[model samples]
Target: MTDVRILGTGAYVPERVVSNDEVAAAAGVDDAWITAKTGIRERRWAAGDQATSDLAAAAGRAALRSAGLTAEDLSVIVVATSTPDRPQPPTAAYVQQRLGATGAAAFDVNAVCSGTVFALSAAEGVLGRTGGHALVIGADVYSRILNRADRRTVILFGDGAGAVVLGASGGQGPRVRHVALHSFGDLSGLIEVPAGGSRMPVDETVLDEGLQYFTMDGRGVRDFVGDHLPRLVKGFLHDCGVTPDDIAHFVPHQANGVMLDSVFAGLDLPRATMHRTLTHYGNTGAASLPITLDSAARAGAFTPGDLILMAGFGGGMAAGFALVEW
Candidate 1:
């Protein structure tokens, strides 16, 4: 089997930086309250005209550059995002057009925050079978869907994008060892955007009720993670024929600062092994994992012959894990 190798990585954040104090004042909370809950001091918001595709294309270009490849080299483009430029066309199509990736098969994947993991798994298989390169991007503009007055969802999300180029391994760089992805749709109601889909389309009534905005049962999500995340990690590592002691690095989703701490406290892995950026970036949905991964990689965190464990969980009640050898 031709294992998928990550050739290069890139991440992009919008220029407009938003501080916790700014959001706290709007949400009728204190800065300390927001920080203590999410461990996020600040996050970035996209510009008025900026959209998810713009962010994805920017990160895609950078990843291609890092890989020493051009847009023409990409055989496919997979974008994972819940906030698309428009509902009619898949977001990846806009990204493909922006990148001028003429021949690439482009599409969108919406597993919410677990989108990157889902898209990566698909990209890996596609690249492996096709014997060509694929660009996998996780981008989200949660700012667009957030109800600014709803502190629960508003303070917890930011906008960003990250990208990676996947191709056949030539006996160098990091190679994907095992990828485990699972979804439990029964718990999907815990997190959702209530309207604007097939079951509930947009209308004056929906807008007045604010059904189009993001909504999350924060405590329910916390309880769900506490119940499932540790077991998922343990089961994935066991299936991959490894243990916590064997992992050189762990890059889980940058969900929230305090939430991550709570989640990690129960896990068997060492604390320092986890890479986190939630303090500064908050929860960037699908972009969280890749952004954290790229930042750590660019910072020279991964070394040769190191086993890296990556995990992500999100809105489909979806979860994914990948074991990589660097």
Candidate 2:
């Protein structure tokens, strides 16, 4: 069997930074309180003109460049995003065209915050079977789906894109050694964007009720993480026959400081082993994990044989953890 390796990684966040005070000014809160609670100072917001596909394309080009390849080298383009450019026609097709990708199969995956991992699984499956390279991008302009006046959800999300090019390899490759994926649909309502879908529309009622914006049950989400994440992490590691000490790094989804802290404590993970991006970009939803991986790789944070744990939890009340051997 061929080993699948992540050849390159890259990311892009919009230029606009929304500060905590700015968000507070739009809602019922203060900067000090927001900062103390979430450890977030500011987050990037895409311009009104920017769309998720644009960011994904930019990140894709960079990832291809990093891999020392061109768009023509890939056999597939998989985009993992919740904030797509449209509700129809997968964003991957748009991304494929923008990259001038010829004859590549393109599609989208919606696993919310765990999107990149889901997309990665698809890419790995392709590589494992057909022996070809694949481009995977996770991008979201969550600001487009937020109620500017709702601090609870608005302050916790941002816009960004991350990409990775994976290819078939020999025995010496970046292997996804183990994984655990679980979802509890009953708690789905705890975190979701309630309107603007086929179930709801841009009607006067929705507009008046603020239904177009993302609405979340923050306290419910917190409780879920506090109760579930540790057990999940422990189960994943134990199933993989690995110990906490064996991990060189822990990269969780960049949701917020509170969720991250809870997961960290529950897992009894050493603070030093955790990698964080929430401080810089808040939560980019599906884009968070891959962006962090890209950033850390560029910073020389991983050695050739290091073990890295990639995990994420979000809107499906879904969660997944994967162990990667670098």
Encode model 2's per-residue lDDT on 1-326: one tens digit a residue: 35777788889998998888888877788888787878888889998888999999999998998888899999999999998899989999999999999878999999899888888888888878778789999999998888878878877888999999988865554667866778889999997878878888789998888788778888998888888888888889899998888888898999888767767777875633788888879899999998898889899998888899999888888888878899
Once superposed on the true structure, which residue ranges of model 1 sit more than 4 Å away at CA?
A: none
Q: Where is model 2 poorest over a 10-residue stretch in terms of lDDT? A: 170-179
Best by lDDT: 1
- What's the count of clashing pairs in each model shown? 0, 0
Question: How well does each candidate superpose onto the true structure, as a TM-score?
Answer: 0.98, 0.95
In model 1, pairs of residues that clash are none
Candidate 2's C-alpha runs over 4 A off are 171-173, 270-272
lDDT of 1 by residue, 86-176 (tens): 9969999999999999989999999998899899889887877787899999999999998889999889999999999988755566888
Q: RMSD to native for every prediction?
A: 1.1, 1.6
* Leading candidate by TM-score: 1
